[model samples]
Target chain A: MAFPDRFDGLPAAPRCEGVYKVTGDTRGNNVAIDVLGVTKVFGAADSGFRALDKVSASIRQNEFFTLLGPSGCGKTTLLRLIAGFEFPTEGRILLDGEDIAALPPFRRPVNTVFQSYALFPHLTVAKNISFGLEMLGWPATKIASTVERMLALVKMEPMADRLTDQISGGQQQRVALARALAPNPRVLLLDEPLSALDFKLRKEMQIELKRLQGETGITFVFVTHDQEEALTMSDRIAVMSAGRILQVGSPREIYDRPTERFVADFIGETNFLEGEAKVAGDRLLEVRLDAGATVKATAPDAALHAGRTTVAVRPEHADLVPGDGPADLTGVLKNIVYFGTDTHFHMTLDNGVPFIVRQQNTPGEGSGFSIGEQVGVRLHADAAQALKD
Target chain B: MQPHEVEQAAIRRGTMRRWLLSAPALVIIFLASFGPLFVMLAFSVLEKGDYGGVKPWTFSFDGWANVFFQHDIFTGELGFADAHLSIFWRSVRLSIITTALTLVLGFPTAYFIATRPRKTREIWVFLVTIPFWTNLLIRTFAMQEVIRNEGVINTVAMRLGMISEPIQIMYTDWAVLFGMTYVYLPLMVLPLYASMEKLDFRLVEAAYDLYANRFKVLRRIILPLTKPGIIAGSILVFIPSLGAYVTPRVLGGGKNMMLGNLIGLQFGKGNNWPLGAAISITLMVVVMVALLVYVRATARAGGDDRGR
Candidate 1:
């Protein structure tokens, strides 16, 4: 679109100047936001809840970074600290190499589209979009032009006169994004803005948000508990559990080679086989399961001569073979689940653990599996990884 | 009966039963309210009798005439006088003042209470309502004691040497205004509290995040959202204060009489029941007109909000 040319009239993105810079990975020149060892404790010192414990991450400029976790895992708390709604009990939050930990919400150059949208019920869509510009003391003409541009950006020009309550939930979400983006904040914090919508609208908005983020070239720090959303839209994802970041990497890295058991379990469905492992050779490890099945997989860590470890593999990677041929494992097929495009074979391993294998629904494939039928499950060594128990 | 006719009859019976359930309360309200009103309307056009009662089958416009015109005893003619008009004007002025004062005091108080933590909100609301349990007359008397010369306020002021002589506060216009404001303060606070409690506090945080200062947040967001409560509280305080009787009669010291006091005088010592009924009906009409105006304004406001 011709939108990028419109922002040329505005000044360049704000940069910190004339201040003594902290020399560390936390405050790099190319980084848009640097959260440095921030610990947030709620309640009193004697007996308090540490909502975020030494959480540190650096978001690159124009990156879609996600803090993904379940509820109460401090993802929203970390977002609030960045938005300046909550103060961290320890450490600093830097914006463009300048510390903004002491700044109020208004003083900081960041805006948040709240999970509830938080639209002013009394104002029209246009008025809500223009609010931040008006607060910044822009001229009426400037604010009007900016508001018009924003409404067009969100494709909400026709509903500009409608109050917030008069619009649907998805429309309100777009208006919130427009309102936050109108001010041209350096970073926009989204606190699960799509969690309120139905499945279809949420999918549409997910793609729209990615497009908007690409068009605006603003750093987005999105917080959500949905792992699929993080994997689909984010340049990098931080997997958090129990107030600590377990892993931070690109989606492919997080999904393919999760460093921790929690990250492997939380990101997607995985079948974890408990076994004893030892380094077989270069780039390979052999794990002997309790049911007398020996499997070879790639070791995630090189310094692993492990006594006890777990082999994690996705259900799609494990295949169901016809008979008791040369196989890595064998189980009894307990159930078959048809899921439109694929079928899942629920099996009980010889060790009495439930194992699932998913196969594509090919046109010529026969109904070769049934309840309580004996089957052999084979795992591709390249697709499986050995993880610390 | 035939089958279809029997079905129709059952439907009729169902409708009748529903109406029968609501008929009793509806009948009682109509009688209790319209009964006295019809009597008052009839009395307003009748002639005054010899013993503080209306004369039957005798009608005149003298009660309405007496409100705006003064009767000359010798010349047997009537002309305009400001006596009754001034009383009505004073009542309007006092009502407006009382409503304004209550709002000025109630808004901040209600906002404070509503902004409090959820655990302590009910306690503050209970404290606001504690005054309602006491008799209003006793409360007015207590106010009189506090504001009277040589009363609590004057005694304390004299001892503190802020003033050597006692202040002439009681039995004045200020005393009546004080009593009205004190009695009706809770009426204003309660409605304001109801709306403020339902206000979405997240909007306030959003406004702050958008760089709005506290005052702008209040002016643009809080005040506009809570306007319904303001209008409701104003009507609650204004209508009653317009026709308040005891406060003006006791604290006004008979020098500055309001419509309520004048209406009472016509029915009591003046022995003119027709004139009293006429004045009461006029005050009722004024209050009704005010309520209609408020409703129209709020409706238009709502329409404007949506139409835009």
Candidate 2:
């Protein structure tokens, strides 16, 4: 694949793909967190296990970047490394071109809203918010103004005097945010900040967080396992697995054009058609299925290898036509799930491979197909990405 | 048929079973703990019999009055300037000294052990408590051997030519304090360790992250947070040391007699049961008051995180 001409003027990508890019230019306010080849190992060398394996990604200033991954994927470790709570085994963390890896958490120009909120039980909300200002030796008047401003930002001014233990979990989250932002860090690290909240509160906080990021104009490196959160709030997302970043791009790029099978499966539901790749054209690849059908998919990132591959087609992208067409694959509609927003049809092909087809709930009618009915599943060639095994 | 009835029946059965199982143990504990104390209280107010046994018909304040008001004949052996106040003052001072020394030595040690990694913490706690497994008298005698004129320290100092002659470490107030501290150090540490173990290291980290220096972290975060443990440890060390008999007897010899020694002499050599009982009751009351005050103070200070 040829490099995009637009990226020619941009700084060269780091040699190792997925390693953080830390440029030393002081002119650009766009780059806030530049992590270079960050790695974290738990325990001593004799018994140590690497938690983050040379994983890195730069977060731009004022952008809400999410590190999305399942548990133990080292996303939280990366966030902590950036927050200066945990030093990387080997890496340089530059905050605004200053090497902050050697600096203590207090000295680093970054603040973290821990997942648990970590609000001091003894302190009032006002005190918790003003702690960072006090640390900087700000005068009482300045500290008070900053604290009041932060409390107002989070809409917690009325409850500023309340003890942290007395408030609801959602309110505590806002207090934590207020506290972190009151410090006016160049970058904000949120470690699964919404995981503790209930579903409704999480959604509300997501919107609130996005707005707060915009209002503060500070980079936010949010860590979460929920792909929906990343899709909803992030300007860019880095999908990690097994302590290494698998893919990094905008949410659309990750969801629509995932680079790896793991990223495809992790980000959203997909029916993986196992097959052998055969080049059809410069940009297209014909994957011969194990079950005797051929699938044409757009090659993602790299040229498809000949031996073995899989075509990732999202369930929603595969449409059920009235009857079999020239390019359509025939299947029996085995089941239908009537979700409020969409209707899902589980279909079985002649070779018995189960394929799921999701259709959005349009105004006039729902899915025309029923259980145990014959249907034809059609997918756009552009919707499927050919991935290596 | 109803849920409430079923729950009520279960609760009744649970209560019945609990009472049935604990009846014997409860009775034994009641008899063992309160019986002696009640007997001592009764003796303090009872009229002394011509014989050794108490006269049940007559009760008087004469025994307490004699001990409190005038120097009884037994004072000669006890060697207190005043019969009651002098011995009481000595015991309070010694107990205070023992408690202070125990806190000084035990708090940091307990903090160290508690802050260790989980597996190492268990091992270190076990090491701290190992000395407690032996008989208290045996441990006191062991200390006696170490502090004696020709003991290990003197021998080492002599061999090193640091001193010309053996130092008089044993049979003094210092020896008594040392023995008391050594024996009660574990008692002091256990409660402290329990309190310190619950201390969230994040609190200290949070303090440090707020630019509070090491000393400020210690004073503002660590010390106040571990106040419950300190109070509990002090009570554990102080109450026991006030009435401790074994350490003083073994280490103090005849030179420095604490209240425990005087009480023992009154009961044993002096054969003054009334005086001994009065003194014992006094010590018990003092300890009880001290413990009560500590509990109330801790409760007021919000140190009772245990919710008891």
Q: Highest TM-score: which candidate?
A: 1
Q: Give candidate 1's TM-score.
A: 0.88
TM-score of chain A, predicted model 2, versus the true chain A, to 2 decimals = 0.89
DockQ by candidate, in order: 0.48, 0.19
- For model 2 the local lDDT of residue B303 reads 36
What are the per-residue Cα lDDT tens digits for candidate 2 across A268-289?
8998787788788876788877
Per-residue lDDT over A278-299 for candidate 1, one digit per residue giving the tens place of the 0 to 100 score: 8898757887886557888677
Best by lDDT: 1
Query: Local error of candidate 1 at B68, Å?
Result: 2.5
Best by DockQ: 1
- Full-model lDDT for every candidate: 0.87, 0.79
Residue-level error in angstroms, candidate 1, position A106: 3.1
State TM-scores per candidate. Answer: 0.88, 0.82
What lDDT score goes with residue A186 in model 1?
86
Q: By DockQ thresholds, what CAPRI class is model 2?
A: incorrect
